[model samples]
Target: MWSWVAHRITGFAIFFFLLVHVLDTSLVRVAPETYNAVIGTYKNPIMGIGEAGLVAAIVFHAFNGLRIVLIDFWAKGVKYQKRMFWIVLALFVVTMAGFLPRHLMHVFGGN
Candidate 1:
């Protein structure tokens, strides 16, 4: 139940993020200065945190999607769906643990 809700939410989050990303990236074709100026807004601390959240959403969405596919396709996967969810969650935590510190350092640590 919760996994379904989370999968939907993360899917929407990634969709919206892709929309914004496309719009912003299209600015590059308009003019280099415009693109640079638009991208500059993402340099702030608030955007840094948002970026981390975006990464988390992406990771979770991907892992959950894989689990769903397995459950649907594999003969025995339905029996272990709950266990797979826990495995996905544990993988998410481990992935975030590795990514967040390095990303934060790059974002917050001085150049």
Candidate 2:
């Protein structure tokens, strides 16, 4: 139940992020300087954190989606759904653990 809710929420988040990404990228053609200025604002630590969140969302959504597929297709899928959810979470945690530190250092290094 919670995974379903999280999946839907993350889907919406990713959609909106892509929408904004498209709009901002379009500015590059209409006004390159404006695009540059808009992109420049993301150099701060706050946006870096936001980027991390976005990556986290993407990773979780992907793995959970695979779990959903297995649930739908495999004959034994339903029986092990709960365990699969835990596996999905384990993967999410390990991936984020690997990603967060390097990304945060880059963001906070002020280089």
Candidate 3:
């Protein structure tokens, strides 16, 4: 029950990010200079931190979704739900930890 609720919440979160992402990208087509400025603004520290959270949300939503699907169709998978949940959690942590720093550095003009 909780997993289902979380799955829906995360799905919506990812979708919201995707919508904003599409709108932001569309600016590139409307004006190159404006797009550059927007990209620069995205480099702001606040946005950089938000990007890290976005990365974590996307990773968790995707992996947990796969786990849900696998368990739904395969009888054998039902028993491994807890195991898969832990694996997904671990992956989420590792992916976010690695991605956040690199993403922050990239957005903040690192080498």
TM-score versus the correct structure, for each prediction: 0.97, 0.91, 0.87
36-108, model 3: which lDDT tens digit per residue? 9887877888988887877777788889998999899989889999898999889888888788777877877
TM-score of 2: 0.91
Comparing candidate 2 with candidate 3, which one achieves the higher TM-score? 2
lDDT of 1 by residue, 1-111 (tens): 999999999999899999999999999999999999999988788999999999999999999999999999999899999999999999999999999999999889998
Error of 1 at 109 (Å): 0.9
* Alpha-carbon RMSD of each model: 0.7, 1.3, 1.8
Single out the weakest 10-residue window by summed lDDT for candidate 2: 37-46
Total clashing residue pairs per candidate?
Answer: 0, 0, 0
Residue 7: error of model 3 in Å?
Answer: 1.7
Candidate 2 local lDDT, 4-41, one digit each (tens): 99999999999999999999888889787999999887
Order of candidate numbers by TM-score, starting with the best: 1, 2, 3
* Candidate 1 lDDT trough over 10 residues, lowest sum: 40-49
Q: Identify the superior model by lDDT, candidate 1 or candidate 2.
A: 1
Maximum-TM-score candidate: 1
